[model samples]
Target: MSLLPLSLACWNYDRTEALANGSVRPEGIDLNFQALEVEETFFRMLRHHEFDAAELSMSSYCVTLARDNPPFVAIPVFPSRLFRHSCIFVSAQSGIERPEDLVGKRIGVPEYQMTAPVWIRGILQDEYGVDPASVTYFTGGEEQPGREEKLKLDLPEKFRLEPISPDKTLSRMLADGEIDALHTARTPSTFYSEPDAVRRLFPDFVPVEKDYYTRTGIFPIMHVVALRREVYEANRWIARSLFKAFCEAQRRLYDELLITASLKTMLPWQIAAVEETVALLGEDWWPYGFSRNRAAIDTFLRYHHEQGLSSRRLQPEELFAEETFESFLI
Candidate 1:
């Protein structure tokens, strides 16, 4: 039997690297996986539907669910989970000390509806009482000159979202104090090239994130695996098989990270980092499927809705293929 050939686009992270390399594949599929940066993959998938399936931004994905006919359907497999507290950078002169200080401030975002801004804004409102509506937002390309949301946002009335001029970029605005702070998944060019130029809102972001997790039990989810709706409808079985394959690939990658004989991946502290994470959180800290990630999923949906990105509040179960809700046991 010939296998179905499908193109997939996603970040080449440890969890998805094996699948991308063809070391692990779905049972009935031949995947042509492209290893690209998250922004590039997202741009291709959301803009052109370039691949049969790929990692998609949760905020953008939710925006499509309310459409008359959404072009994609997702499995419960989340390709990326990141804490967004560290994603914020503040101009040193802003005098912004904490999350609450962001009120009435001007903040630049790569895109207003991007997943990182969603997570950061949600956390800010829930934890520190900083309403997103209170802050003025400038949205545009993170480094380049012009970029727009793949899916249009239906933001609430009175929510101020300004478009940065094509001549200016978020990094330039942040560096020149045109914006008091910037919220983004990627660090601003100045933040990297000149450390002191901009500092993280929370210098001790790790501990603050740990505390936030301890209180809410929510590790923010960034991206999820989505299948094209036409392809998904024609091949429903791929949903289950691909979900299993992704899980297997992640397990294999995690095991590789624990290899102590020598460095298998990343740095010398690779093993220690895993141990510390397990000690701080749990062994299955990064989880797939709704069962284990209920809180995280529900929280994200709530944020997406409250942030005005979603037309209506979406239940976590509604965001995924129905068949993926309950897996089989043998």
Candidate 2:
């Protein structure tokens, strides 16, 4: 019998490594893992039938695909708090010290309408009374989805947006001194390229705004892994097996990459984040699956719509594979 050829699109090498090492072996499967930079890029390929399955973020962009595009099932994995964090930085020499100071200033980002930028702007408007409209934005040259063209759907129209070319991406501009501020939700991300940028802004610059966002019911940003609904529904075992493998990998990767015995000195939240991740995983062999996180996804999507981030709300099942929803019950 010919084995199933399944493609997984994810961010880091760990997912690829896990599958190759036989840690996440699915039934009737010959898996090929493709590491990608952006979830949107992965989804674009998914629409063209490039891969049998995929993992994408549950952002408005991804969810919109599940609704309007083909029959892809999206399973929500990981808490937004655990998955990602948004960062906004100014040149140390710019003297734009706080959120309020962002007014009339040019801000650079990869996506203008993404959750991270929206929340950042929302905070600026509500807490500091800054005008979000006045802040000129540069979206780091994202290509419009080809699916939009095929569907004859006006996806970008639902958003107040304009596109910038890849050459004008935020990182390149930050390096060229063309923009004054850089903001994003990715860690070990583009912003880290400017080593001395933070010290120039404040002799002592620490990430403070994220805590404020978390306290305000806006969870910290996180990236997710999405799948097609049909692939998931037809091959339910593959979803469960993949989730189990990821759970195992998350623990192994965390212990190896993040936790350091020598860094004995750390903040309380830093320690808490690590501890929480470990506690949640426990002795389980699979920590990476969405079967356990339905309520969290539901609550999160509701907030996205309520805050006007996504135009419509999605059911938890719509966000994940229905076959595996019962796994959370166990």
Candidate 3:
């Protein structure tokens, strides 16, 4: 039988490397995996429908669902999961010492609809009583000029979002004290070049992030594998096939991490790090299925709606292809 040809664009993540390198082919599919940066993949896929499938921003996917005839349908296969406490940078001279101090301040974001800032805004509101509507958000490129939101956002009147001048980058604005803080996925160049000018809101972020996880079991999913809706409508079984392949790839990675005789990765303490993570989070620390991640998904959906991104609160079950929610028993 001839396999169906399918193209996918995503970053070269360790968990998905097997799929990219052709070691783990999805059942009945000839995968053309293009390894690209997250931003490029998102832009090409979101703007042009460049691939059959791609790693999509979680918040962006939810936003699309609000529109008639949403472009993509996702599997629960998450390529990136992060605790975003370390992503918040505040101007040292702005006198924003605590999360509460962010209220009424001008904050720069690469895009107001980006997944990282959605999670950050949600966390601040839930954990520290910082309302999402209180701060005025300045949106634009983080490092370069002429960046814009990929999707048009019809946010509520309470939220204040403005675009920085075409020539101005958020990193420079934050460093120059033009914006009081920045919530972003990538660390701004200014954070390293002008350390005194920009500092992490949570200087000791590891402990704070760990505590946030303990209190709320959300590791915060950033990106999900999305199939173009037309492709998914034609071959629904591909969802399960791809989901199984991704899970198998991740399982191989987990097994590789447990080999203590010689370090499989560059880190000298990879074993210790894995052990600590397992102790903090259970054996299935990075889960992929719907049931396993329902709470986290629900939390993010609520955040999307509360922050005026999603038109209505979407159920977690509505986010993925129906075939991905379960499997046949052996």
Candidate 4:
């Protein structure tokens, strides 16, 4: 069988392991898969025409692409409900006993524009009446925020923002008390952390409720796999096949016995985290297909716009390929 030319890019998370291992049938040329440190950098590679396909954070990718209107188009693999358990975790030692205690605190986030923490912080500030400026938001490393000027997102005042050179080391610092909190948008904590080393302050932070998850759908907080418009138009069959393969992979992975076994073999706490995520997401949060929920996607767009993260008001439909999505659904 002739292999298709597909280059898959993803964030540095463990869930992608299933995708990397051909959990679904491998399609496209394995130009070799690359996992990136942040969604912003991953999108940079996409814009530079480095790869054929990639999984990106839907909200972050949409906003970034909408800035100059990149030639690529996103096809969401799963609804946002699948991302419910992704959270803002605080260290138990930090004495951040409650979300209300986060005021004027130094928060350590994985990336400059990760979606979960942005919303969590906004909820704290806007809904809880905390001062945004008092909160110190630090990007892990030295890489500066690229979309800041283009998107015009307002960062917190006097923030200790710096991108981490090695993202793994940033996680270490978080464990060692170098940072107060880590913003996570993945179900499994092992992708960027060790739950054993750090006690979770928000063990019950289920940002998306079940009804909202099933209805308006969960926003893509973590990864969104996208294809360039021209490429997608030419190789529509490949797109369809890849989506099927990915969904199949997710389905197999989410199988309770298999998932529990996989976790059991890894670590006790890892298993716990997976179970926690499963409990939070219920049974529906598995990758199925690239069906973009316009309303939920718009929530992200409006949020980024309100945060001054993006200058342009991105319409969700512009970022996704509706025709292809419809084909998948049908």
Candidate 5:
């Protein structure tokens, strides 16, 4: 059997470090792993098809599904999962005390169609009775200035979004009181330099996020591994082979978390945290595959469609390659 040489672009995460470093490579693949920030990977992959396979934003991926000809198909491998509650930051002096208080305020985002902002906006509207149209949006860079959306979206007429000048960053705007709040994946520098300038919308997001998980069981998936559709069609077996490699890599990470006696982690209670998380989410907490994560994926598609990002609600089956849908009993 001939092996394929392929490019895989993704972020640098401990769980995926094995794949990047070739410690656990996909069978039959010679992978050129390009580790980069999420925004950069998503932009390059979605725009230029820069890699044969890449970790891509879920929201932008959904949008692509609605387009006439989607360029890629995804595997259920989610490299990043986060609860967006902590992503919301507000000016300390803004007087916006709760989620409901965002109704008439100005919020800044790196991109409206970005996965993190989609989750943030969807959660606010669903849990807090705040329509996206009720608030104004400012789109720009979070720390450095002049960022633009990777793709275009036809946001509703009532939903106001202003493109900030290339010179003005969201962090600076929030600190200067130009914007009332900031909704971004990046932690803006203003919060670090001037701690008093801003505070998290959920001051202690852990409890709120825990309650949210109890209610919805959504850990909030950020990125999915996508393969160029042409490449997938040409070499269908690679999908399952790749999925298996990712699963093994993830299992190695989870197994290491159980190494408490020797202290695999620097934190004194790192093992305890891992044990507690398993008790809460389940043994295979950070799972891949459709069956394990159907509810979260379904809910995300619903929000994406409702928010006018996707032309239609794309099902999990529709977006992922068929080879990745099943696994053998080994």
Candidate 6:
């Protein structure tokens, strides 16, 4: 039988390296895995549908689902997961010492609908009682010029979001106190270049993020692997095949990380770090599949709806292909 040719665009994550290097091939699929930067992959896939499959922003994917016919369908394979407490930056002049201080302040974000900001805003509201509607949001490029939301949003009147000037970037704006704070996925250049001007909201974020996980059990998901709807419609079996392959790849990564004889990564204490994470989050800390992530997915969906990103609340099951929800018993 001929293998179905499929092109996937994603970052070079250690977990997915097996797929990219051709060490693990998806069943009945000719995988053309393109290791591209996350931003580039998202731009090309969301704007032009350039690949058969791609790693997509979870928030953006949810935004697409609000449409009459979403262009893509997702498998449960998450390529990126992050704890975003460290992503929040505040201006020295902003007088924002705590999360509650962000109320009635101006926050710059690369995009209002980006996953990191969505999670940050939601976290602020749920954990800190800082209502998202109380603060105004300025959207623009982070370090470059002329950046805009990849998809059009029809956010309600309660959410005050405006675009910064085409030439202005969020990093500079935050340092100059043009915006009181910044919520972003990437650390801005100004954070290092203008240390006195820009500082992390949680200067010691490691403990804060770990505490958040202890309370909420949500190690936030940033990205998911998605297939073009046309491709999924014609070849439904690829969802399961690709999901199994990603699982296999992740298992290999775990094995590599456990090899204490020689460190699989550059970190001299890589095993110690892994041990610490397992102690905190259990053996399968970074889990895939619908059932394992239902709480986190449900929380994010609620945030999506509350923040006016999704027109209606979406269920956890609605986000993934049905085939990925379960596996056949051996």
**Ten-residue stretch with the least lDDT total in model 3:** 321-330
Look at candidate 5 and tell me the lDDT of residue 266.
81
Give every collision pair in model 3: none
Model 1: residue 43 alpha-carbon error in angstroms: 1.8
lDDT of 5 by residue, 1-330 (tens): 767998889897878878988899899998898999877798899999989999999888888887777899998899999999998999977889989999999999988888888889889999999887788899988888888988888866776889999999999889888899998887888888888988889988998998999999898999899999999989988888888898988988888889866876688999889888988889898888888788899988888877778767778678787787765413
lDDT tens per residue, model 3, 1-330: 999999999999999989989999999999999999999999998899999999999999998998899999999999999999999999987899999999999999999999999999999999999999999999999999999999999999999999999999999999999999999999999999999999999999999999999988889999999999999999988999999999999999998898988888899999999999999998879999898899999999999999999988999989999888875312
Model 2 agreement with the true structure over 10-64: per-residue lDDT tens digits: 6545534666566656557777766656555444654564555555444544435
Shift of residue 45 alpha carbon in model 3, Å: 0.8
- Whole-model lDDT, model 4: 0.57
Residue 230, model 3: lDDT of 99
TM-score for all predictions?
0.96, 0.65, 0.98, 0.63, 0.96, 0.98
Q: Give the TM-score of candidate 5.
A: 0.96
Whole-model alpha-carbon lDDT for candidate 6: 0.94
Model 6 CA lDDT for position 25: 99
For candidate 4, give the lDDT of residue 152: 29
Global fold similarity of model 6 (TM-score): 0.98
Off by over 4 Å in 1: 327-330
- 1-330, model 6: which lDDT tens digit per residue? 999999999999999999999999999999999999999999999999999999999999999998889999999888899999999999999999999999999999999999999999999999999998999999999999889999999999999988999988999999999999999999999999999999999999999999999998998999999999999999998999999999999999988999988888999889999999999999888998888899999999999999999989999888888888775311
lDDT of 6 at 248: 93
Look at candidate 6 and tell me the lDDT of residue 217. 92
The lDDT, on a scale of 0 to 1, for candidate 3 is 0.94
